[model samples]
Structures are given as structure tokens and as C-alpha cells.
Target: MTILDKYILKRYLITFAVMIMLFVPIGIMANLAEQIGKMIDNEAPVNEILIYYGNFTIYIGSLLFPIFLFLSIIFFTSKLASNTEIVAILSSGVSFARFLRPYLIGASIIAVLMFLMAMFIVPKASAGFNEFKYKYLKRGREDRVTTNIFTQLNETDFIYVSSFNPARKSGNNFTFERFNKDNQLDFKISANMIRWIEKDSTYRLTSYQKRKLRGNREIMETKRRLDTVFNFKIDDLTPVSYVAETKDLFELNQFIEDQKKKGASNINAYKLVKYKRWALPVSAFILTIIAVAVSSIKRRGGMGVNLAFGIFVAFIFIFFDKVFGTLAEQAGFSPLLAVIIPNVFFGVLALYLLQNAKR
Candidate 1:
């Protein structure tokens, strides 16, 4: 690389490294404080807690790096302007856009790293983090837990559980109903309690009742014990207790597919999750541009003012992100649109600001 390239790169690297070191430990400490009590209450061992926090750090660091990189660029580039170094470069016949070459190069590197973290590393780590939380920190397990969870396994059937306990391998107050092509309930099954035998992969239900329709008549009968296994898999039970972020991308994708087949109504939630994983990394690029453009120009008010402005802009970005995401899910906008819409708008804003900065 040229001397100028090496010099600029060195400055950016120093600033980026400092911000990362500062942010990562704070992120770790904040997470540890929030989760440590839960782990202790759950009787988790120290080693397990350590491992959990280590995995959490990887996840947090991956997410925090892009914002830190953006802030670092702003900090150092603003310093260059305040000290008249940029003016010196301009007087030496270097174009402002040409001067941005090193910053863009650094941003490109960060973008690739962010993409890798979002697509591959973060998802895998999330699995471990979530497993630790569910197995150790959560209130109960999927099979031995008590929850009233619902999901559509297909379009025709809506499944419901009034209450289930993993320890008993059973559920109480359960109902599964199927509606006909005309949206009329053709069959319904209500059971007082349902139990599972892991060794045989079957459920032994108690106080079971079946209601059959005969073209305008209803037939209902009750039984004391019924031994049968439903079509649903044991793996399906996990999603009942976990949120979308707790599942990896592949898990989320499979969940949406399974739910769709079962006629699930909440596939949009999974779709939003899938879109968000990539959208978050792409947002780093736009935020980086905005940070660079905003701080590359010197002001009489100095670096502190610039830093405050950056913080405000960051908050605004996050606020809009959540707002638009809610609108996307509740208002029935496309999941892809919900995730990318803010980024698109902010990207244009960044571009306009950069153009004005160049002038």
C-alpha cells in the first residue's frame, strides 16, 4: 500500500481497536449483571455460567463491532478536520472524495465481517446461548414444562393446550379441532389430560372425548385412557417455548415451513426474523456512511458536539427500526419490506448528507 494509505489505515485501526475494547467489556458486564442472578437462582455451576457468558460475549461483540466502527470513524475523522489535517490535504490537491478512500476501505472490511457474523457465527452462538438459557435459566423444559402454547400445524387444524407439564409428561385441558372447507368445525377432540412415553414415542391420554359430525348431527363419546401418538414431532415442542431470536436462521426457516404445513398463522413472525438477520448487517453499512459524512466536516463546536449528534442519530435509527418493524408485522406489510424499509430510507438520507458534505 502507499504511504498515505498506510498512514490513514493506521489511524483508523487505532481508533477502531480502542472503541471495540471499550464497548465489548461494557457489553459483557451488562449481560453478566442481568443474567448472573438468574443462573445462580437456577443452581447453575460457575463453569457453565462462564461458558454461557463467553458465548454471549461472542454474540454481543459481533453485533457491537459495526456500530463501534462507525463511531470510531466519526471520532478520528472529525479529529482530522478539527486539527486542519484535512484542510492541509485539500490544499495539497487531494480531492475530498479521494481522501475518503481509506475510510471506505475500512468500512468495506467491516461490512464483510458483519455479514459473516450475522449469517454464520451469530446464529450458531445464538443456539448455544439459547440452549443454556432454556435448559438452565428458564422456568421449565419443553416436555416437563407447563405452558399454554398454540401453533398451526396446517391450514385445517388449530392446536391448543390449556396447560402442560413436562415433569408429568402430560397436558391438561387440551383441545384440537378441525374445520371443514366451509370454515365449519367438522370434528373436535377434547381431552382432560395427555401424557407422553419417551421410550415408545406415544402419548397416553386420559378423560379423552371425541365428537364426530354426521351431516347435521353430532356424536360425542368419552374414554378413560387412550394410547396414541399424534403426527407432530417432539422437535415441534421446542418452538413453543422459545422466541424467534433464540432459534438460529435454519431453525427459524424450518419452523416457518413446519408451521405453514400445519396451517400456522404466525409465519410472518419467522419471516421477519429471517429478514432481520441480514438487514442488521446491511444497516451497519448505511450507518457507517452517515457517521463518516456527519463527522468528516469540522465545526466550531468541536468533537463533543459531533459525538452527541452521532448518539442522537443512532437512537433515531434504532427507534425507526423498531417502529417500522412493528408496522411491518401488525399492518401486514411484507417482511422483507419491514426489515429493509428503514435501511433504504436512511441510506438515501446518508447519501444526501454525503453529497452536501462534498459540496
Candidate 2:
């Protein structure tokens, strides 16, 4: 609203925009250079390749937003301090806290953008990006789990498989069971192999056997083959590894609830995706404070010294995020803690640096 707020806010937004514009193409080029050979080998379509880069711009750019914002602030604010603009403003009776108002506004703007992108937009981009990566880029790797698969369709229904072939829509050592309301076994079915008959829309079970409980007696039946239908889909066995990242906010919440009901082993991985979206926006404020604090003081090494410090802090922030994220995904750590720790640590650091800057 004030002249000073407008002036600082304009520079804050412009520098961030410029930083993204400058670096995103560099990222695309670097990615293309690295993955071009793979594209050639796989005979990927031209249109899909173009689309992948577009998604790449959204996905990777959103991932690096905090760093870009941080570095941009340090870069521009360092220059302002170097030119004695900060000193002049302060000498004119502007409080340091008042000077920070515009920076907070800029951070607020970026945070909302990040929240929107992460919750809705980037998920679509992420789905497309990871789909392309797995389809053409990492063809040899299995996108879905293929062995020892288990899923609970409902409170009373459970299924298990020793091994599954997703392409064939078949599995070996298949077993299905259902229980009564009293938790008593109602019936159990086993098969040497089960395959989905696409033309008939039925599941064909080879070497089938079924056992039914009748009060205290067990009745057994066997058959060479049987065709039947079940409520659960084959894809429910093991979805793609990035399944969580592909869902919008509402869908993701519903998905996590479904997975929890089914006793999914990788629920932590899904939770990590949800928690990070919230954490990413909160980080915008923390990073902004730290960036301004570190870069607002004139130094002998000028902007170079401030830039170096910014980069160092940025690296550490990213390092902590990746480490905790990996732990949540692979090591079964708490997803909330993974998102909370890095932000809290950096938040405290920001407060310390802001006090020093004010002094």
C-alpha cells in the first residue's frame, strides 16, 4: 500500500519470476541432454516428449520453488544493502520490521501458488511425468508390485497371491477368504493359478478348492477349474509406486482412507505426499525470513558472500527434506515428523538470524 511496500514487493516478485524463467529451461535442457539417448532407444513419440517437458517444468519447478525464492531474495536484497538503499531507508525512520512487510506479502503470494499447484495442478503433471518415466524411460523396472501381494477388500473379505503377472492379469497360489459377522470363517477358496478372462469378464481358477464352515463341520469341494466373479479388481493388488503422488487433495484423502482400511503396507508413503504439500507452503514464509535476514546486511564480500550463505542454507534444507522423506517412504518413519522437523529447524534459524539482523 505504501510506496516502500510497493517498491520492495515489485522487486521481490520480479526477481523470483526471473529466477524461475532463467533456470527452468536450463533444467529442461539438462534433462533432455541426459535422457535423449533413452528416448531414441525407446522410439518415443515426439508429442509425448514435448508434453513430458511441460510436465517437467511444472513438477521440477514446483519442487525447487522455495530454493528459487530464497536465492532471489538474497540476490536482490544483497544488492540493495550493497548500494546503501537499506541504510537510507532505515535512516529515514523505517523500522526493520516495517521493511519486512512487503517480503512477507511476496512470500504469502508464493505460498498460495505452491499450495494450489501441489494440491491440484502438480499432481496431474506428476502423474503424466512419472507415467512417461516408467513407460519409456525405465522400461525394465516393474512399476507395480509383483510378488507376495495381499489386500483386504472389506472387513470380511481378504485375498493373497504368491506371485502376479500384471500383463497377463494372472496370479499363482491364489487364495480368497471371507468371514462372518461373528469373526467365524465362512468360506475359503484356493487355486493353483487365477487368471482374468477378459472376453468373458470372469476369473478362471485352475486346481480350485473351496472349504465352507457349517457350525462345527467343514465341507470341502474341489474342481479342476472354475470361473467366477469377485468384487475386487486385480489392480488393487499393487498399484503403481507413485500412485499417491498422482491424486488430487480430496482424492488423496479418500485414497489414504481406503488404503488404511485395506491395511496397506505403504500407507506411510501416501501420507508423506499429503504432508509435504502443506509443509512446502509453510516453508515459503520461513525461507523468506531467513533470506531477508541473511542478505540485508552489507558485507566486505558484497553480494557474493550473501549468495554463498544462501546456497549453503538451501542445500542443507533440501538435504534434510530428502533424508526425512526417504525415511518415511522406505523406513516406515512418521510422515508428520518428516515434514515438521526441517521446517521447525529452519524456522528457529530464521528467528535467530532475524534478531541478529535487527541488531
Score every model by TM-score.
Answer: 0.81, 0.93
Candidate 2 C-alpha lDDT tens digits along 1-359? 99999999999999999999999999999999999999999999999999999999999999999999999999999999999999999999999999999999999999999999999999999999998998889976656778888888999999999998877889999999999999988999999999999899899999999999998999999999999999988788778778988999999999999989887777888899999998898999999999999999999999999999999999999899999999998898899999999999999999999999999
Candidate 1 structure quality by residue, lDDT tens digits, 155-266? 6876677665664556677777888899888898888876778888897778899898979899998899888878775444334433565566577677677766764445
In model 1, which regions exceed 4 Å deviation? Answer: 141-188, 192-204, 211-221, 234-252, 329-333
> Clashing residue pairs in candidate 1, if any?
143-166, 144-166, 144-167, 145-166, 153-262, 153-263, 154-262, 154-263, 155-263
Tell how far residue 35 is off in model 1, in angstroms.
Answer: 3.6
Error of 2 at 225 (Å): 5.0
> Model 1: what TM-score?
0.81
lDDT, each prediction: 0.75, 0.94
